[model samples]
Target: MNIEYITTEELSKRIRYDVRTIRERLKDSVLIEGIHYIRPFGGRKILYLWEPIERDMVLHSGHHTLAIPMANGGRMNG
Candidate 1:
């Protein structure tokens, strides 16, 4: 399998978001660890996986639903 890894700056350019926003706002909330990014060799540097991020962006782009997370790990779409 082939995977494309990208830096935070590169991702900011591609997604048209500020690097600061990605790092502060979206890092752990929207873009999850392991799924969206990885710390190579357990280092502090984070490399994002392009394919999954792209796929998720496309998948969620058309949705107008609001998801509210429940305490029991369920989500309610409004």
Candidate 2:
């Protein structure tokens, strides 16, 4: 099946932020290049993969914004 691709504009609308903000603020810091977005056919146009974005949002949606590494080779907050 041919999967549908979404533009940064679409992601902005879903996340309730300006498209420019995503590119300027969250593009490299939060959203990795190939993981969250791509340049189609080596072109400059960027398309975001919605599935990964949704999964990451779900995975990270929480109270604590810190990633405290535990001594047991894991992570926790105190």
Best candidate (score: lDDT) = 1
**Ten residues in sequence with the least summed lDDT for candidate 1:** 60-69
- The per-model lDDT (C-alpha) reads 0.94, 0.85
Pairs that clash in candidate 2 = none
State, as a TM-score between 0 and 1, how close model 1 is to the true structure: 0.78
Which residue pairs clash within candidate 1? none
Measured against the true structure, the TM-scores of the candidates, in listed sequence, are 0.78, 0.73
Which lDDT tens digits does candidate 2 get at residues 1-78?
565579988999998989889999999999998898888899989999888888898788853466688789876855
Reference-based lDDT, residue 3, model 2: 52
| All-Cα superposition RMSD per candidate | 8.4, 7.1
Question: lDDT tens digits, residues 1-78, model 1?
Answer: 999999999999999999999999999999999999999999999999999999899888855467788999877887
